[model samples]
Target: MYLQHFALTQLPFSLTPNTAFYVGLAPHQQAFEVLQTALAAGEGFIKISGEVGTGKTLLCRKLLHTAPAHWRLAYLPDPALSPMELRWALAAELGLQYSGNIDQQQLHQLLQRHLLLLAARELQVILVIDEAQALPDETLEALRLLTNLETEQRKLLQVVLFAQPELDLRLAKHQFRQLRQRISFSYRLRPMTVAEVAAYVQTRLSIAGNPQLRFSPFALNRLASGSRGIPRLVNVLAHKAMMLAYGRGQQQISWWHVRAAAKDTEDVQAEPAFIWLSAALMVVVIFGMLFWQWGPL
Candidate 1:
């Protein structure tokens, strides 16, 4: 809605993980490097765990975009399926033709054969499962079994799991220990730092065709604090602030706009009083420093 008002071609703060708006910040960059190194090494299981709204999906999409051309990728955005369904999904991804009436054993055989064929062609098959914490225990085990389909040198099917922090807790349980142990590389994505938040906002705006425009410095600070450095929250607050500024016919987003927008967000509303208190403290500190430096009695 604020696109035209902001002289932009598209929404800058959309929740969807648009790779076009991807900011290669430290956390995300490191995650990318880890993924690249792990996949290149032919690691069996790779896991990336992040808090909700920490850009796990975005990172996933970025990885897909940058993966080598020779790699065959299968993405599973939903992991609610049973083991049989999981096998069928993998089979479908690998372009295996099978009758619907086929049983579990047939499905497994078909998947194995397909993996072997892909490996023979010197192609790396990667199965990326998002929301992996939602997968049933049986399904996870089934995935582990799938990784067993390997050649003498390396794994045939590499699995990269992207999930919320709960997935780590799930993996901690004794029931999932076997599957967890197979993870050769894992990265925990952290929330953006305040500096990172500022950079992230600017990066998104620039990508949306607003390279010269920016959130005011104070507004950027407020947004970073209010968003608690979560990219999703930052996007939510920034987008709302932009819309509010547009409605007011203002060109610049101010701290007040960010505060109002933060109030409307569920996760960010927990520290309303603290936010104002912090703002007041900052003002007092600035005034005191100025008085000490330049006051005359």
Candidate 2:
């Protein structure tokens, strides 16, 4: 709604993971490089994890889009499936067909044959699973077993898991030691820094065809602080700030607009009211303690 009003071509802060609007800030760039290098080396299992709003899904989509022709990629965005369901999903992704009445043993054999077929054709198959933290222990073990499907040289099936930090905690347990050991490479996507947040916002704005719409330095600082350097939160704050600016027929986004946006957003950016309230509570407690230690005059 604010696009035309702001003279922009597209909504710069849309939640959809559009690769074209991808900003190569340090963390995202490092994650992409790691993905490319590890996948090229045919690592059996690679992992990328981050906090909830730190852009793991965006990185996953970028990997899928940029993977080399030799890579036959299978994407599983939902990882809640049981081992049997996971097998069926994998089969469907790989375009393998079998009778509905097929037993687990037969299905496993069929899947193994298909993997070998891909290997014979010189294609490297990679299974990219997002939200991997939700994958059950049995399904995770099943994935490890799938990686065992290898030629003498390299694994026929590689897996790249994009998940939240909880996945790392799960992998650290003794039961998952084997699966954790097989992860040849792992990258943690960090949140954007204040400076990077400034660049990131400008980058997205430029990509959306409006580089001239200025966010005041004060506003940017407010955004960086409010978002705590998280990209998704930054997007939400920025979009709301812009809409606020547009509502008042303003061209430049100022700290006022950002503060207002933060106030409206749900725990995204810190609100001045909340900060002041906390400060007041702290002062009251300190005074109360002083009165208890030394009687008021």
Candidate 3:
């Protein structure tokens, strides 16, 4: 709604994980490097886990778009598949064509054949699974078994998983020991620091063609504090704060805008103690201005 007021080419703080808005913050950059190195080394299974809104899906997309020409990537945005369904999905990703009446054993043979064929053609086949935390126990083991098709030097099929921290918890159990052991490389994505969030917001604004949008120091602090460094929360608060400012025909965001936005948003932590102190300070400033205007009336 405020795009014209801000002179932005697009909405900067969209919740969608748009690659164009991606900023290579330290944690995301490190994770990307880890993924590249691991995939290049032909690792069997690589896992990346993070808390909610940590941008794992965006990182996965970045990898998909930037992989080397020799790499063939297949992406599964959902991972709640049964063992039989999982095999069929892999077979499809590998370019295997078959009728729906095929049996499980037959599908397995087809997957192995497709994997070997891809290897012979010197293509690196990678299966990227997003939201892997929902993967069934038997499906997880089935994934591990798929990596067993090797040519004595490297794996024929490689898998990369992007998931929430729950996946790590589930993998810690003894039942998943074999699957856990196959994860040759892993990375954990952390929430951005306050400074990083500032840069991230600036980067997104710049990409949206309005680098000059302004936010006061208090506004920035409230944004960081309320969002607790979560990228998704940051985007939500920032977007709403800007809209509030625009509603008042103001060119800059103040803490008041952030406060209102934070209160309206769901799942944002209730204001901490320091925020109350800040609010009190703002009240004092407002009363002080009124007194000056009316000669202490």
Residue pairs in candidate 1 whose N, alpha carbon or C atoms collide under 3 angstroms: none
TM-score (C-alpha, index-matched) for candidate 1 = 0.92
Could you give candidate 2's per-residue lDDT for residues 190-263 as a string of tens digits?
Answer: 87888999999999999998999889998998999899888888999999999999999999999899999988
lDDT of 1 by residue, 125-228 (tens): 99999988899988899999989888889998999999998889989999988898999899999989889998998888898988877788888888888878
All-Cα superposition RMSD per candidate: 3.3, 6.5, 3.2
lDDT of 1 at 131: 89
Q: Please state the error at residue 133 of candidate 1 in Å.
A: 0.8
lDDT (CA) for every model shown?
A: 0.90, 0.91, 0.91
Q: How many residue pairs clash in each candidate?
A: 0, 0, 0
Model 1 poorest 10 in a row by lDDT: 267-276
The better-scoring model by lDDT among 2 and 3 is 2
List residue ranges in candidate 2 displaced over 4 A. Answer: 269-297
Candidate of highest lDDT: 2
Question: Pairs clashing in candidate 2?
Answer: none
Using TM-score as the measure, the top candidate is 3
Off by over 4 Å in 1: 269-297
Q: Candidate 3 residues 157-197, lDDT tens each?
A: 89999999999999999998888899999999998887988
